[model samples]
Every structure is written in C-alpha cells, then in structure tokens.
Target: MHDAISYLLFLVGTFLAAGVVKGVTGMGLPTVAMGLLGTVMPPASAAAILVIPSFVTNVWQLFYGPSVAQLIRRFWPMMLGIILGTVGGAALLVRVDPVWSGCWLGVALMAYAGYALIAPAFSVPAALERRLSPLVGLITGVVTGATGVFVMPAVPYLGSLNMSREELVQALGLSFTTSTIALAAGLFAHGAFQVSQLGTSAMAIVPALIGMWAGQYVRMRISPKRFRQCFLFFLIALGLELASRPLL
Candidate 1:
C-alpha cells in the first residue's frame, strides 16, 4: 500500500475529491476522504489520513465565515448539546469494538439519508427547538467522537434551523472543531495518532481546501433549489457507503 504508485494515486485522487466536496458544500472533506479511503484502508487509517485536513478546513470556516457572533448566540442551545454528546461518544471509543463502531457510523449515515429524504425542509418546530436541540447536539458530538464521520443526527438537525448562510457556516465550523479535537485526543489515547500521520494529513489538506474553495465559487452560481438537490444527492451517496461497509 505504501509503494510509490499506489501512494501517489491515493493522495492525488482522494485529495481532489475531498476538496471538491468541501468547496461545494462548505463541509464534507472528512466524509468524502474517509469514504474514498475506506474502500481499501481500514476505518482507522481512513480517519487518520483526514485529521490534519479536517482540522485545517474547519479552522478556515471558523475564522472566515461571516457573522460568527450572531450565529453562536442564536445556536447556543444546540451547541451545548454537541459538547456534552461529544464527550460521551469519545468515551465510547475505548469501550466499543471497532466493527461495532463501523456499524454505528453506518447508522448515522442512514439516519441522515432518511432525514434528508423525508424532511428536506429545515423548519424546526418551536416545541422541538426547546426540547430536541440539545439532544441533536449530543448525538452529533458522540457520533463524531466515536466514528470520525459525522453525517447524521447532528447535521440534519442543524440544517433544519433557519440559519442564514454565514451563520450556518459558523455553526458547522464550531461543531466540526469540537469533534476534531475530541477525535484527535481519542486517537492519541489509542496510540493511533502519530507525528508521521500529521505530515501526511497536512499534505492532504492542500487539495481538500482547494476543492472546498472552488466549490464555494460554484455554489454561488447555482440557485437555491439546485443546491438543495445536489446536497440531498450527496447525502444519499454518503449513506449508501456507510450502510454497505460490512459487505464491502
């Protein structure tokens, strides 16, 4: 796997694909990278490859997105839940089997698909807003911490809120930031985190960021309806990948 040709092809293809997804969606670098690598590599290796890239891309969003303060204030309810949930998910990492962990990831992706298919509209009910917001965050955090892929329960709930584009960007940025930090810590605890992977992950960051930035430009050109269609399509694909992991 570490031979020159295989390594070169993996880096180039995965980097470009990850970047394209991020550029268009404002997130998904890790999802795309992990999905592509998961075809061949173990889940841990897939996750390890994206660590630096994920951290860098989220950092870019955290600093560059407009209206951070307003978004934080408005979204605090859900954010708090994410923090708590992430802690629980991270703890589960030590206790759970890797195969089961993979299955949990599949559940998250499938759940996201169901949500996207049935309730594409993001209008959260006022009652749900009061009760469900924190739970959504917790689920997002836990899934993120244990699985290294966070597509489900968290993103769908957040997507439902009536956030302006910039505010949405900020919320996602913060969520990913918390999750990444937790994931890094867990990997370190398991002796999976290494200085060598840092360099490789850093190298992968270039294409991932480029793809995301380019996607922003294209996103601006697309109308709202078209954008949503594309978003849902991507979510479906992500879901299938997760659901089929055992067979693969």
Candidate 2:
C-alpha cells in the first residue's frame, strides 16, 4: 500500500516538474516526463501515462493563434506523415526490450538538447517547404515512435520556416498536438495503452497545470533564456544517465 502511494507521489511530482519546465521553457513537458518516468517504468508505460497531459496542455497552445487554418492547410502532409510513422512504429516500441528503448529515448533527448542549444540559423526556401516538410515529419515520427520524444527534425524544421515568434509558438503547439494524438492512437491500436490507465493520466493533469501556472509566474521573475539553457543541460545529463543505465 505504501509502495503504491509512493509511486503515485513520484508520478505526480514528475508531471508537475515537467509542467513547470514547459511553462518556463515553452516546451519539455513530454521529454522531461518521459525522461524521469523512464527511470522508474518502461518507456511504453511512461508514454501511456503521458498522453492525456500532453494533449490537454498543447490544446490551448494550438487554438489561440490567428493562423490555424493557414498552418493546417500548409502542414497537413506533415501531420499525416506523423500519424503514419507512429502507426508503423508502435509495434516496435512495445515489443522491444525496455533497455534499448530507454537508450533510444536518451539519445533523442541529447539530440534535442544539442539542437536546441545550438539554435542554428537556416531556412528552407518556400519552394522546398512543400517537399521537405513531409520528410521532416516522417523522420520526426520515427523518432517520436521509437522514443516518445516529439521534438526533432520537426521543431528545427518548423524553426526554419521563417515564422514570427507568435506563429512559431502556435506552430509548435500544432506540431506537439499532432504528435500527442498520433502517439495515443498508436498506443491504443497496439493495446499498450488501456482504458483503465487513463484515470491516473487524467488525474495527472492537476499537477501538470499547477506546475505550469507556477512556472509561468516564475517566468515573470526570471530569465527564461537562462532557464532554458539550464533545462537543456539537465536534459543532457538525464539523457546520458538513461542511455548508460543498461550498460551500467
């Protein structure tokens, strides 16, 4: 009984912290949640619990933008590609040994951290966006499926689209929402995610929201850029530890 309570506490704390990171950094909820939870549970279970909180938080981010219709019309191919890639890889995610999946997830975290830290400057020509977006989505989908971390080629690709700051945030929301929904669908289809688990997932939102609120408040007082740098560095350390867990 105590063990169950401890587990629940730890789970709540993980989401809460992840939420705070998102509020401050404008991202990292899934990556942080998955990284921490992967320490205590298999990647599949971590991902299953991640579905609801991720979807709910990203929804508000998705709808508040002025160019939803325009973004959707432009990125539909990428969205479809994410769904297809997730469906294709769901079986692998569930069937593989947890050790390898954890390693992949860790690698993904490191890659994302590296890319985000560098914040490299480049852009896809408008002429190439139509062709490159789907490819980027497909690769992002594979990464998302294998590790359940949704940032990658997708975020960088989106960054390269030459959007304004506000559009970029909303665009990120759209991308994350699509990934979350695809992930849930893939899990449901594979029977890795069950109805019974959803209650706890729903409950998790309370802490996540609270943490996000706290983070937003903190954001008003702190340097978000510095916070994000620290956060990314933390992800690198966490990723290294996770990747090395099996070897150790």
lDDT (C-alpha) at residue 29 in model 1 = 74
RMSD of 1: 3.2
Tens digit of per-residue lDDT, candidate 1, span 217-242: 87788774566566556656765766
Model 1 stretches with alpha carbons more than 4 Å out: 73-77, 91-100, 125-131, 217-242, 245-248
Tens digits of per-residue lDDT for model 2, 172-196 = 9999999999998888888899999
lDDT per prediction? 0.70, 0.90
User: By summed lDDT, which 10 consecutive residues of candidate 1 come out lowest?
Assistant: 86-95
Task: State, as a TM-score between 0 and 1, how close model 1 is to the true structure.
Answer: 0.80
Q: Model 2, residue 207: what's the lDDT? A: 93
TM-score of 2: 0.98
